[model samples]
Target: MTTSTQPQAQAKRDEHTQPQAQLAVFDMAGTTIDERDEVYRVLRESAEREGARFSDEEFQKWMGTEKHWAIRNLLTIGGVEATDELVDKAFAWFRDELARTYTANPPSPMPRIEESFAALRAAGIRVGLTTGFSRDIADLILESMGWTVGGGEECTIDVSVCGDEIPSGRPAPDMINKVMEITGVDDPAAVISVGDTEVDVESAQAAGAFSVGVLTGHLTKEAFAAKNADAVLELAADVVNLPQVAAQ
Candidate 1:
C-alpha cells in the first residue's frame, strides 16, 4: 500500500530569525540535472518488467525518496507482493537500467544551475549535492558531468550525500543532516536546501534550513506554492536573488 501522508508540525520559515546559509544543498535529478522524465522512463520500464504498474500520481508519491524505497512503494501500488527479495531484485534491475541509460545519454545540468553554483562559491558559500540516487549512480552522474567531488577545501561540489548514505530519505531530514555533518556546518539555520518536490521542502523545513522550491523540477508553480516553500523561484538561477541567498 502507498504510505499515508502523516501530518507533522513544520518548522516556521521565519525570515528575520533565519541566518544566511553557509552551505547550500541541492538535489540531483530535476533540481540540478535535467533527468526529469528520464528517471521515470527507467522506472516505468523496470516496473513493467517486474509486473508492477504506476500511474502518474502513484509515481509522484515517491518523488524525492530513495530509489529502493520508491521501488517498494511502486510494487505495493501495483499490487505486486512486496517481498524483501523481490524489492532487492527490482532495485538492482532499476539501478542497472538507470546506469545504462545514463551512461548512453548523460544528462546535463539544468539552466543557470551551474551559474548558481559559481555564484554561491564566489560569495564564499559552500555547495553540496544531495540525491535520491545511491552512491554509485550519483558518482556516475557526477563523473559524466565532469564535476569533481571530495577535497580538503576546494572541489566542484565540496561534498555530496546520496540517499543510500542515510537511513531514510527526504521528509526525514536525514540526508540534509548528513550534508551538514560532512560539511561541518553546525547551525542548521545557516543552510539552504533546494529540491523539486514537497518532500524536499519538508526535509529542509525539518532540518531548520531555508527551504527553496525550484520550478524546473518535479513540482509545478501551484504545487510548490501549496507546499509552502520559504521561497519559490522560476529556476535555479533565481535562487541567487533571494534575500537569504543575496545576503550570503
Candidate 2:
C-alpha cells in the first residue's frame, strides 16, 4: 500500500539536537516534501503512448531519478533503444501531464514536512533542498507552496540542488556537497541527509553525513538498511516528532 501520511509519533523529531548542528538536507519528491507521484504517473502514461509498458516495480525504480537519466535509463533497461528524440518526446509528454495533474490536483507538503521545516528553522538549523526533480518542476512545487529561498516570509531553503544542476545524480555525494557548499557547513557530522532510497543513503555516507531513511518514496526498510543509513523512519514530517531529529 502507498503510505499517505506520517504518524504523529514520528512528528516528535526534536530530540536529537546538538548545539552545533548546521544543516538539514532534504530530498524532494518523497523525502521532506511532495504533492503526489506526478512524475511517475506521467511517465507511465508516456511509456504507454510510446508503445512501452511499465510495471509497478519498474516505476518505483524510476521515481526519483534525474529526468534525463530516468528517461535514458528506463529506455535502456527496457531495451527500448532510446534516442535523444525519443527521450525528448517522453519528456514532453511528462511535462504536459505534469501541468495538468498539478493544476487539477496540486500537491502539498508531505505529512509533518512543513512542521519539521519550521521546527528546524526555529531551532536555528539551516535547511536545504536536494532533489532529482527537473528544475521546472522543482520551481513549481516551491512556488505552489509560496516558499522562497532563504528563510524569510517564504519557506526558504539555504540551498537547492536540482536534477538539471548536477552532473551526477543520487548514490553520489555531488548534490549533497553542493548543498554543503551553499550552506557553508564543512563538517559532515553536523549535517543530516533525509531521503527514501539506497542511493540517498549511499550518497550521504559518501559525503560522511548522517542519513535518515524515510519510507515515503519507492524503497523499503530493508532496502534502505542495506545501504547502512543511520536511521530509518516513515516520512520527513515524522522527523519533526522524533526527538532524535527535532531535539537540539
Candidate 3:
C-alpha cells in the first residue's frame, strides 16, 4: 500500500516539475529570419515616393508594427493627408518593393534557429510563428525557407499567425492570442512569446505570457530591459537555453 502511494506521489511531483509553457511563439523577420532590414527600408522608400518625408528617428518608432499602420503613421508624421487611397498606394508600393528585394536575395533563418525549434518541440512544447507581415508575404518568406506549418512530423512549425489575420498587430496582443487559439493553448501563462522589438514584449505582457526579447533585431538589451522583458537573449536561437525551456 505504501509503495502504491509513493509511486502516485512521485508522479504528481514529476507533473509539478514539468514546464508550464505549452507553446513558444516566435516573431518573424528580425526575430527568426534575418531580412537585412529591407522591410523598413522599403517602407521608408515607399513613403518618400508618395511625397512623405520623415527623419530616421521618426521612422524608427514604427518598427515591428503592422506595415499598413506604419505607412499610415509615417505619412501622417511627414505631413501627408494619409487618406485610405494614399495609404493603400504606399502599402502596395512597399509590398512590391519588399517582394522584389526578397526575391533578389531571399532571407535566411537566424543562427541555429532550426535547431532551437527542434529542441523546443522535442521538449513537448509546440513551436509557432507570429508575425506583423501580411499572410501572403509571410507565406512567401516561409516558402523561401522551406518551412511548412502544421502538426505533422515534417512540418517546420506547429502553427503560424500573420498580421493580416488579426484585427490588430503587435503591442495589441492579437497575433499572440491568435496563435494561442490556433494551437489550442487556453492559458496565456502556458505560452512564451519571443521577438526583437518593444511591441513584442508589450504584446506578450498584454497576453499574460512570458516574453523574451532578442537582440538580433532593432532593439538593444537596455531597451528590452526598459520594457521589462522576461528575458533578453543575444539571438533567437538562444531561447532553447532559457531556464524555463531548458529545464523542460
Root mean square deviation (Cα) for candidate 1:
3.6
Q: Model 1, range 89-121, lDDT digits (tens) per residue?
A: 988988998999999899998887877887887
Q: What tens-digit string does per-residue lDDT give for candidate 2 at 1-248? A: 01111111112123255335578898887676666667677766776667665567776666666766777767766668788899888888787778777777777778767767777777777888888777887888787876678746355566688877876776667788888887777887787888886667767777767778998877788887666677788877665544545556
User: Which pairs clash in the backbone of model 1?
Assistant: none
For candidate 1, the per-residue lDDT at 241 reads: 76
RMSD of each: 3.6, 7.2, 9.3
Candidate 3 error regions (>4 Å): 1-19
lDDT of each: 0.80, 0.71, 0.82
Error of 1 at 238 (Å): 2.1
| Residue 117 lDDT (model 3) | 91
